[model samples]
Target: MSLPSVLLRLVASLAFATLASSLSHAQSGEPGCRPEMAGHRLPIQRVQLAKDEVRLTFVGHATFLIETPGGVKIATDYNDYVRPPVTPDIATMNKAHSTHNSRRPDPAIKQVLPGWDPAGKGAAHHDVTLGDVRVRNVPTNIRSYEGGTDYDGNSIFVFEIGDLCIAHLGHLHHPLEPGHLRALGRVDIVLFPVDGSYTLDQEGMLEVLKSLQARVMIPMHFFGGGTLNRFLARTQELWPVERREQPTITLSKAALPTKPTMIVLPGH
Candidate 1:
């Protein structure tokens, strides 16, 4: 079957299940799950933009708190373990894996969005905007164990802030197909896993980067040892690596690299 056809079937099944669950709850005198928010709208908070600074705090692994030029604070994969965990204006989570999704997050957050929540009733298409930044989700597959089918419903998200479009490949287990590439659109920076266990291996990740042609690549989810070095070595042949002194770095759209580059930040 075609990718669109497969997507349609998955969406249909989800809708039917949601409706059935709602009816079952109605009969049981319990409120059914509230239909997902229209357009899966997330609450937005405003901030005052400083002169030229775009502060980004790397909250360990795939989690990042980005403060955009217009003062919008956005968090990606806001799991619980981030040391010095930050309370941002918005947080995005993917429900695929436990480590990347949290039901209990910092209460100070203004809006919390799951990456798969759709707008207008169909399976959600990822496109959210807050202040001067835009956030999108790209669906992909997760390989299943026991010879089961792959979980194609999984998503990898991308956030477009100012002039930079950063993509977080959430627990991606496979290389990108052509359709996945088209859905991802443009990516300025990429946060990828190099662990080679739970996610795509180092070689698979390299293929993904080449296909996306992102300006900068940030490696995450490495379990220490030489795994990170292996990932770096593979990419260094094609892209320059900038090992940073701090756990976090700041960037503007204009400061983003033109050729593919790797930025290795300190982690907990």
Candidate 2:
């Protein structure tokens, strides 16, 4: 006896899905079970965004509260001191310092992705998709307190939503290499640290920023106005700077600036 044609087609479709899932895991170096995408579909934002818009709110420090069109909320460098007002669906943390990561994350967060591996393994890799948002990370090294190299200690998380790719450089310590650039393809917006001391030096960071060639560059992690002003002064000749009064900014792919511009949102 032969199976029905419809049953055979269903089996083939299931097989293709499994193969694609496995391939995705292999490429991202996150083997085993994929991230669960349940319970994060609730629309929690006060104002609904358009299908092609993404809202970014400066929550202070390196944390930026990102809201997608599908109502998925993401918090970058999620820490206790500086956190989003509302609980985020996905939280990404870096372990470079206490302020970059949180020991106790909110239980309401469905996904908590650490930049480094907690089990003392290799780099931490994540490729998760939830509600029209796809989040991934590119591992990078950080400076150890002992003046040594902490390999794969930080991660540069990239959020893909609404035809835009927003990258958050988490506690970065050095300039990106060729391999890193290849991994991060077609970056539209970049959120980078501008302290110039803890992260990469000012010159090196500026070089990295140029190499990325993103349309919009947003500065983060600077402690004070003096620090941010210095960075802005250096780049004034290279790119135009826009200091926004509000802490929140909504962006869409079609509405991006024509040239590379630096956007400074008001916040700590």
Q: What are the lDDT figures for the candidates, one per model?
A: 0.72, 0.90
lDDT of 2 at 1: 36
Model 1, stretches more than 4 Å misplaced? 1-53, 117-124, 145-147
TM-score result, candidate 2: 0.83
TM-score for each model:
0.74, 0.83
Query: For model 2, how does the per-residue alpha-carbon lDDT over 133-153 read when each residue is reduced to its tens digit?
Result: 999999999988999999999
Looking at candidate 2, the ten consecutive residues that score lowest on lDDT are 33-42
